[model samples]
Target chain A: MTAAPTIFLPEVPDGDDVGLAPSISRFELERFICGELPPERRAVIDRALAADPALKALHDDVVAADRAFLIEQPPLPFFQRPAKAPSWWAGLLSHWHAGLGAAAAAAAVVVVVVVATPDESNRTKGGVEGPRVSFFVKEESAARLGHAGEELKAGDQIQLAVKDVDKKALVVVGVDGAGSVTVYASESVQGGLSKGAGSPRVLPASLVLDETTGPERFFVVYGDDVDTLLQAVDSAARHLGDDVKAGRADLARTDQLPLGAAFPQSSVHIVKIR
Target chain B: MSISQMKDQELLTGLYRTHGGRVYARCFYLLRNKEEAQDALHEVFIKVHKNLAGFRNEASPLTWMTRIATNHCLNVLRAKRAPWHEKYKQEVDVGVAASVAGGGGAGFSLLENRELLRLCLAKVATTDGSLAELATYAFVDDMKQADICVLVGMSAPTLRKRLREFITICRAEIEAHVPGVVFAPAPI
Candidate 1:
């Protein structure tokens, strides 16, 4: 049989070399940077980098790229169990309906707004200031602001809006009476939720109250890192345990969620009458 | 934080700092779009974070990460139903014409021409996905047979057979794209 026709191709570049000149493998360089390498191995790489300008250049380029990435996407904070609310605050929460009524009468608004007491740890850490969520109920075609402990019917459409916070990412999760969780709104891969400067920003989507009867709490988790925000919300949900899921627990009076001080959080609590 | 927790944090931070760029580069190389690559980069890191414990034992964490990136991108390409070969049909035709006219024989360097490389990869990709992955290390990364064996966990003979199959598919694809152009199988 005749020999197969030769296909002309350039020599395969050595996998270990970064650029034109030969050097150590990229993995070795990375290990060096990470301080994972043994001292002797580190010395070898150091000498190689020192001797080869091309290797040094590659190292610098990698460092700069990682630096830019870190700047754009910062590291997530460590998880921490949230502190318990004071006994006095818990006592005040027991008279939540009376408090809500007084506040509503003072404002002369149809909606009763219940805002979570900001976590003191967050405040002490100088977290985002005045991060507040407003609840709105839809009646017919017109939507009105919603208030805390309002009797909402099944299938009533409601929405949430945020004001006085400038964060790169936001996630809103709802824990219904049945303890089933729903994500109302979240940041997209392209970027965070779109908002106008210094204006109350309504989320793009609205929620229709489910048939589950009892308290429905919406938690707003906001931070610069979307991944961390999601993790925090998930961790908090896990911490709520079976009591909330069994509909035996009132989330509003429950201790704050176990989110780090870095994430500014707020919540709106409403009751489903049906 | 506990001492163990602190160490875990440092390890994760170091991993991100050291290999994040290379991972991004690998993602961009395969996906060929900045936005898609960015999405893939985040996804790959999530996998890395989840598998962080296993990384310390890995002989070559970069290779392990590359495998993850390749698999993820291939899945994406499959999900999008993007015909990678069809997208670069015009480029292949033009390159073939240039090579024939210039009397450069019947072959060209695969890595030197990225469009052709992508076209070959698309043609070689199959339901198994291993063949395309093998082709990437063999052709794109230019890894040695021994290294490819270790990276992919295949015997040398199996690798040769799979590569031969990959070449057969690529040859058929090139002929189909540019009629009258017959490629001689290059040595693996």
Candidate 2:
């Protein structure tokens, strides 16, 4: 079968008559649906929708499309699927930067990739390890420090800031969730960060969380060489849950991390979801 | 009770209750296949379970999930191109041919019609640079212009201009692919 013909866009003329309905642009309608329009403009579209059944039908169609587009797939048992990031998720983050110029600047930052040893003598009440690496999540606007077990709500813009991180170290970040493990960011995988790049700093971009975002433990693996460190990251990325379930994945374990090994040096930071 | 205090299963149940329908719909439309869509939905819920606690509430949960589902499905499509999409395409083609015949693809469910619609929307990416991303946000994701602006880091005027161009191109493409399908919203 022949491939469908590609649609080529014509050069859009300035003030081109794009055949929109009178007094209502497509932008206005979309914004109206999202409740982003001003009250006066919203009232104008409201009158338009009320006056014209065709316009109302169009409105209904968009809503219907939105609904139709959201067909949920059936659920499966969590253990049925591997606990690794789907192959596509790696490219998923790159999609956000495809046409989004400078939007990366707005993304949440990873201030430090802390790798610490677990000390049973210093274990906390909730099974949290005594934080080997000191990290802070400070609300950008309020400058309020987020404690290790503090609750953060939606709309909270935080910077994951770290102090005294190794300048030559590579940072690997991975999330161990209820069902799957995903490596959302890695300084080594992404590209090695210089000392300045790896310095203690608040993620310049704001952090946003959601309701299904459960308590997460971010594992920050530090290494001297990007490639050498990432070998362990790749191993971790591939076997995030396998080793974790056996408790063998713990970086603090002497077996997991032989002291002075180029790889296996990392810290785990756990954030409580409230 | 605090949301944080809820069990993992309970938290997922609540999220599924609130956004499940939309998340499922978005997955089905993008994947255009029942089984894969179902798989995508489960993956989305898992990600939600992992990420929801840190949700910043800037956008509604529905919006957040829709964004998640969109990217997830796109990834699914991108990974296995040959057999998966080819089979899906043939199915959609048969459905379209049936629709043209007068039954309006009665054999193909209404869900198929919407799936076919998204299939055409996905084609908008093939046209040229930037249009694919723009089309995804505007038509597939139904994002607001203001949010699109922040997302793409384009000025309002640039965003509007490109979107208008996008509308014109997508309408022509969708119409060509699915004759008489009124899936494209009327502009203005």
The best candidate in terms of TM-score: 1
Per-residue lDDT tens digits of candidate 2, residues B78-164? 666566656766776675665546454223332224555555555544344365556566544545566667766887679777777
Model 1: per-residue Cα lDDT over B79-166, one tens digit each: 6554654555666667655655655454555455666677677555545477888877777665666777878788877887787677
Provide the TM-score of chain B versus the true chain B for each model in turn. Answer: 0.83, 0.66
Q: Whole-model lDDT for model 2 versus the true structure?
A: 0.47
lDDT of 2 by residue, A95-192 (tens): 22231122222332222222231221211211232112223443432243444434555434343443323434444344444424543333322332
CAPRI verdict on model 2? incorrect
Question: TM-score of A-chain in each prediction?
Answer: 0.49, 0.40
**Interface RMSD for candidates 1 onward, in order:** 12.4, 14.4
Cα error, residue B105 of model 2, in Å, equals: 17
True contacts kept of 2: 0.02
* Per-residue lDDT of candidate 1, residues A1-274 (tens digit): 2222224433333232242324355545654665557788888888888888877987788678767655443333221111231111122222221222222232222222312222221111233454666667666534577666678886676556665356777766666555555444455222333444234555533444544567767777677866666667766765563578665567756534567777767777778776
Off by over 4 Å in 1: A1-7, A10-274, B1-11, B82-85, B88-108, B178-188
- Give the clashing pairs for model 1: A112-A147, A112-A148, A113-A147, A113-A148, A135-A146
